[model samples]
Target: MAASPTPSVSRAPLGTVPPTWLGKRPLPETSDGFGVRKPTPPELRVRRFTLPDTVAMLPGTGFASAVVTPAPARVIARSTWRPGCPVKATDLSWIRLTFRGFDGARHTGELLVNRTVVDDMVSAFHDLWDQRFPIEEMRVTRRDELDAPPTGDGNNTSAFVCRPTVGSSTFSQHAYGLAVDVNEFQNPYTKGDLLLPELAGSYLDRSWVRPGMLTPAAIGAFAKVGWEWGGNWHSLQDRHHFSRDNR
Candidate 1:
């Protein structure tokens, strides 16, 4: 039999809850059987603020392509980078690439990564583009976004956020531009009772399979370049995360 055509996906604005999740009861536990708990008061406070999605979805110009250049200081000023960040701005590279979107159209996206891994990142993403893997959005994350309210529905594909590992003071690989998170809403961070995009519980049911969700092919694309997928971690499942050191 012929394969079914891919379903077209509508791009919902950030913070918009899918109808499927509305009125659904909070997940009682994680797939590992660990009981889910409520977010703390501070976490609840952060969720009160909402930010609009402002990424410009430009049409892809041609074939899948990647351009890596020095990360401009001016652009770095707007990102999470600071004077004391782990990596120097001069050691970072700004990458512009084309990706297939869930809309089944081509789109342009950008990322900031360590210069040392520029080739690895480019090669992996180029393979993903060739595989027609869809990404919902990709853009540089701003420093101010660190404190922004949790929309619990963001799906931005990003790298190089100057933040520490969750629940720890040590710097995360992303702080050094050595890690990336792709389609985070489709592949959320889950540990015990905590989920980064809190409303992303539905995605834990990976059996449903949806566009933009990482597949074994996608994992292999990054793995071929020596990056490790967080989904393989036994202590926690960070389905959207990939890093050079498997942190």
Candidate 2:
């Protein structure tokens, strides 16, 4: 699967498949290539607002669990989807699952993904949950939030945003609902001076090994289902990303 360029306003023709690593290039020496030369200020890492957990956990059912169903019409209405998007709403599924939060409490979260990969995503997240991987939050991406003012410290775990690739006019795998971004603040996307969540520079220091940070084991959990981790990419590191096509 080819990776789309950075987020852009132009749209690709319907059904057009983007080329792999479309606009990727080597990072400059000054760029934080896989290590951090300077740390971000604590204030910059703080979230502008914290979203309250939306689901309650029941007592004594201490195992990872998931529920999958057809994508709800209401969810679609709030999502970034519009007609002519790469994937149809009917081909997507809504998933709700239990995850361990940074606070070490179990919480329910939701995602929207292509129906074909629904089982794979369920299995991968269950493994993470069992391993006690901490995710700050998980929810559907709303259309209004796509270009909302950057909170800088967002860590929303989400899948599916109907938009072009980061720097190109091509549709992102995300447009097809085949990609997921987990804990964006803890494991951010970085490429040649560009960071997805602009204030997440501190997380570039993979050596810190904080909770919610993805490990080799976590990568393996997704790999088990044939999903590729962007952390493994050479030109850029999207540590929070996982996708079916190595995008």
Candidate 3:
């Protein structure tokens, strides 16, 4: 068969073949990319004061003459009064606080409770609640009502999922247990599946009430109670949520 016609193929010019070790990584950006996080001035300022130990044991620790910070809103304008659970000036030990969730469930943490701080936190929540739920027909659910587990990474939690990245910080005001998440159905995290459509009218919205679209009024209510909003994050947002200083 004529040596099978020596089936040979021709090669292209040596330079036409690409280098075998070429890299595909993208080139780094020069001086300007965009969307960097800017720092905001913190609004909270702390002042020390004595709290009588006798008042610290009241249920949820109500207050009387606490030396709290003035509420930004007027619903509880006289919050400068005594706290429900004032710390005795002599006892500098931190007190445990219960951060309530939309459900009645709570996680325990501690904070420096002087009459002033507790009163400030309470008055803040009161005004916040009134502003956030202004419609008379609408009602704010008790912290005990929404019982999802805390940020679930690996630890055991009764909550639907552990979202530590979106939760109170280890050093957070929430560490002081000064925050809560109401109607979690309203605050859907990016993890897992999306929330049911039925909940949209109340808690879920892509705009003013979406993950990062939370309103200042909504944030203020929880912040007054010492809870910080996850919505404040630039890269992510949780509309129906609140926590304290990231803890």
- Measured by lDDT, the strongest candidate is 1
**Comparing 2 and 3 by lDDT, which wins?**
2
lDDT of 1 by residue, 1-247 (tens): 9999999999754323234442234445556332343442322221212122344544446545454567887779888999899999988998877777765566777799999998898899889988988776778999977865454656689999999887679999999999999888778898777887776676677897866789999999999999999999999998999999999
Give the worst 10-residue stretch by lDDT in candidate 3.
Answer: 40-49
Candidate 2: what lDDT?
Answer: 0.74
Model 3 spans > 4 angstroms off: 1-117, 132-176, 191-204, 208-214, 222-227
lDDT pick, better of 1 and 3: 1
User: At residue 160, what lDDT does model 3 achieve?
Assistant: 14
What TM-score would each prediction reach against the true structure?
A: 0.77, 0.78, 0.32
Q: lDDT tens digits, residues 1-247, model 3? A: 4566767899753422323321221223223221121221121011011112222332543221223232222212212112322222222223333332222222232233333346544454355434433110111122332232221111001111112233232332222223344333334343223222111223333444432223566567656566566656655544444554453
Ranking by lDDT: 1, 2, 3
Q: Which 10 consecutive positions of candidate 1 have the poorest summed lDDT?
A: 43-52
Candidate 3 local lDDT, residue 56 = 37
- Top-TM-score candidate index: 2
Question: What lDDT is reached at residue 107 by model 1?
Answer: 74
Across 173-220, the per-residue lDDT of candidate 2 in tens digits comes to 999999999888778887777776665777777887766778899989
